[model samples]
Target: MADEINRAPAKVQSALLEAMQERQITIGDTTFKLEEPFLVMATQNPVEQEGTYPLPEAQLDRFLMHVLVDYPDADAEHSILRIVRHEQRAKQQSAPVAQSLVTQAQIFAARQEVLDLHMETVVENYIVELVMATRNPKAVDPELADWLEYGASPRGTIALDICARSHAYLQGKAFVTPDDVQAVAFDALRHRLVLSFEAEAAGVTTDDVIERLLSRVATV
Candidate 1:
């Protein structure tokens, strides 16, 4: 996983595009394919951060999701503090590290099961329409018509389906639902969209547009 990727140079960020999309990175004269279940997790600092570079749109599209990590609440922060103190105490005592409960094979099998989860045609169409709305916002609401410079690509469509199915599987459901799609839509589609100057000038954000589309789009 790449942390604070926005601190990397433009060329360094561009280099990751191929590895992320194809799961292969070429070095010298040889190209190597990553093993199964390969995933890339990159964290970006806000553009307003000092010395942070904005990732190009192409590189951004290679990512499946763009999750915004908010600060934890008081209760969660207290838990985190306690956990860190415990770890420090354990390290001081040289306590043995706990063994992993899940194995690589188990993770692979779980992926297969998530892929096998069933999705109905109506839900599939709903996913498509959600992506389509990003492209043609005018159809859903005229207020959103000029808010986007570009919409999500076909990759967004594929990501929405897989992520929704995975969400259902995690919930112990055998079938995908419209709610699952909506739950994951913002993260899956936010980075894929390019906002227009008009939207920016009006202080609109990708999340705002995504929320609007979700409310406007019909399930059928």
Candidate 2:
């Protein structure tokens, strides 16, 4: 996992993502395959954007979710303080956190379960419509045409479907629904979209555009 991934140069970002996509590392003329259950979690400091290089759309789309984590609420902050003190105490006592955890095989099996979850035709259609809307927002609403520089690729459609299913699975559901799609749409598509200068000038974000798209695009 990388912190301040935005600090990495363009070539470094490219190499990293290439390794992720190929699931292999290359040294000289040799390539080595990555082990199963490979995952990369990265963090970007939004407030410290001054020196950071903005990740290109190609690199951004490599991530399955672009969850925006914000500061904890008052109660959560107090709980965090308690957790820190508890951690210190645990360290002093040489206590470990919980020992229980899922293995790679278990995680892979869960992924299989998500793949097996039933997705109805209309829900699939809804996902397609949402992606199509991004590509051709004017087809959905005229004003949206000014907001997008370019729509998401077909890859976005696949990402949306898989993420929606993953969402439903995580929620302990056996079937996928429009709500499942809605729950994961923002994180799935936020980094995929390329906003227009007009959108930026208007202080609009991809999240804002995605919200509008969700409201307008419906299965019914």
Candidate 3:
């Protein structure tokens, strides 16, 4: 896990870019391939925080999803406290830790299953339209034209398709639907967009633009 990644300098971020995009790393004289199902879990403070740097667009594009983590509710916080207490007690007693029930192979299989989930032609077009709207916002609505300085790249298209399929699969569905696309759209596309200065000055957020995109774009 890359904890507090925004604390890292530009050079380190560049190295991570190669690993994330090519699934390989280059050392002094040799390159190494990352193992299958390689995943990167990174955390960062908001850019407004002290000593934090904003991530470059290329590096940001490499990330599949950018989820905002809010404070947990009271019930969840209570559970977290209990978990910490249990861990402390276990450590004090020198008790053996429990093994994870999930296996690596199971995770690989689940990923494959998600990829194999059916998505119809119409649904595929819908995903494309959503991404396209980001590129040419004026056609969708005049206000969006002023709000966006830049839109999601082709990677966003692929991310949307796969993420929608995964969402459906997790819901025990055999096929993808428009609702699945909408469900994952905010997390998948929010970071990819570059909002205009005008939008920011007006207090327009990426989520607000995304909500507009979802409302204006037709399924068919």
Candidate 4:
């Protein structure tokens, strides 16, 4: 279900990622298919990078997103403590089965609804332009010329479109907008970019460049 991939060696990581992409594993004489709704959520501990090998760009592209999470705030921490204490106290009594918010069938159906959500022509163009800018940042923003070594692949373009649709669905909206695209651009594109030495020497992050691109890319 979940793997702490940082503990694995480079060869292991490559094999695991290959499985994630193909949704199947092959042995000497036979192959097996992964079950439906099969998802592999991988995370690495942020503390150290001692013996682990970093994933390459091609392998990273197989993932749909790369979200960054931070420590919970005081309120959240307090809530977590309360939940733990409550769970401990409740162990003496029989607990009912937890209800799922949405089922697999519902999710499959919702995927269609999300696809049906209207995206105007201009907004679709905006999504393309945003990814296109990554390839030729200097054309729109001169400063970005020295910041990037290479741009995202065509996978980034498709990611921007579907992710925006999902964002709109989460918002209870029936349409997609530039704002929806903007909401997901960072997570969808951050891992796909390769920055240059000039950008690294100045402590520039992919987020910084993406933020600038979002601001400068034209919507109309």
Candidate 5:
């Protein structure tokens, strides 16, 4: 599954999914499954659509994270240029950073720590409220009601919870916060949303709808 590209040719993508379905190849091995969560990082040159295929909604929903990588910053670009200028010298230089920041044991420990994060009833309710609002925006605000075509499913709620826990763990926190939930809300819910024709015609995007849901749903 990690090798599967959502933006590959339709036939290629279909073959990949079919292979997974047939169990021709196990997605993540037992060690990976037990250690780190399975994640498929796929990239497509957005500007080049000649041989590229758009990802189907079902495939998109299978992904827990949909991060967008932007262009490098000025400092990064300068560093790249400097390295290129000193290519001969750089070839002889060893990397200053450590090869691995955290070991497998540490990663497993972090996963356990993430699971131990305190999730109060109120926080759980807040997570549910956010997911439910996606389905029926009218309950949250009448104005957003018309913009939504379809609501998120129960899987969305689960995704939100896992992402919030991951966010908390990244911050070295023992407890999840409303900020963690908010930070991961868009990535967890955006792809799961099905937009209406009207919304598309109006140029409204999934990010916009998710933002509206976030604003309408209360933390407490």
Candidate 6:
């Protein structure tokens, strides 16, 4: 992947994909059947162009989420500042916020509950329509048809469904909601958009594409 990214040329990318397919190179191990749903989480710095190969659209589509890490919030920043000040005041002082609230067992239980969240057929169709609209915006809202370069993949639908359940579990709900879908949409669909060169040149981003998709694709 790194080598192909450095090459950047379309031909190089095509050749690399072909080689992987021919060799059946598992980018990573699959614990289940080939048809089973799988999710891959990858990280890349959008600002860094040095030595890093930008992921191709096809490769990016394989990822289930593209989370962008931000800096600490105001409260966290204040706490960090207090720690630093205290450290400077007394060398013996240690940093604060050293407490573990949830155990590994608790997290495992939470995941189980998330899996048990009910997904009605209506909600399932809603998820599908939302993802489908990304590919063919004209079907949902004609105004968005010209803004998109390419739509998301089927993997996106799976990601949305799974993450929605996870969100509902966190919220102590036994059922998924439209809000749950919205909550996870950005992370699930951001990387799947294949923006046109014009969109890129215009400073449009994946987030913009996702927002448009959400507006055009309605819930049940």
Structural similarity to truth (TM-score) of each candidate: 0.94, 0.92, 0.96, 0.89, 0.77, 0.67
Better of 2 and 4 by TM-score: 2
* Predicted candidate 5 versus true structure: per-residue lDDT over 57-160, tens digit per residue: 66666667666668999999999989887875765795545477677788778778888888878888889999889888899888677778888888788888
- Model 6 root-mean-square deviation: 7.0
Worst 10 residues of 2 by lDDT: 45-54
TM-score of candidate 1 against the unseen true structure: 0.94
What would the per-residue lDDT of candidate 6 be over residues 1-220, giving only the tens digit for each residue? Answer: 2422443656655645544334332444532233212223334554456655676777666555777778899999999999898778765565555688887777778767888889898889989999888888888777567667788888888889988998888788889998899999999998887777877778888898788777777787
Deviation in angstroms for 188 in model 4?
A: 0.9
Better of 1 and 4 by TM-score: 1
Question: Considering summed lDDT, which 10 consecutive residues are worst modelled in model 3?
Answer: 95-104
- Stretches of candidate 2 above 4 Å error? 95-100
User: How would you encode candidate 1's per-residue C-alpha lDDT over 115-141 as one tens digit per residue?
Assistant: 999999999999999999889999999
Candidate 5's TM-score:
0.77
Clashing pairs in 2: none
Error of 4 at 32 (Å): 1.2
Q: Which stretches of candidate 1 lie over 4 Å from their true place?
A: 95-98
Off by over 4 Å in 5: 1-6, 15-37, 82-101
Error of 2 at 165 (Å): 0.7
- As for candidate 1, its clashing pairs are none
lDDT of 2 by residue, 141-212 (tens): 888999998888887899899999998988999899999999999999999999999999999999999999
lDDT of 3: 0.95
Instruction: Show model 3 residue runs off by greater than 4 Å.
Output: 95-98
Q: How many angstroms is residue 162 displaced in model 5 relative to the true structure, after the best TM-score fit?
A: 1.2
Candidate with best lDDT: 3
RMSD of each: 1.5, 1.8, 1.2, 2.2, 4.5, 7.0
Best by TM-score: 3
Q: 3 or 4: which has the higher lDDT? A: 3
Sort order, lDDT high to low: 3, 1, 2, 4, 5, 6
Alpha-carbon lDDT, every model: 0.91, 0.89, 0.95, 0.87, 0.75, 0.74
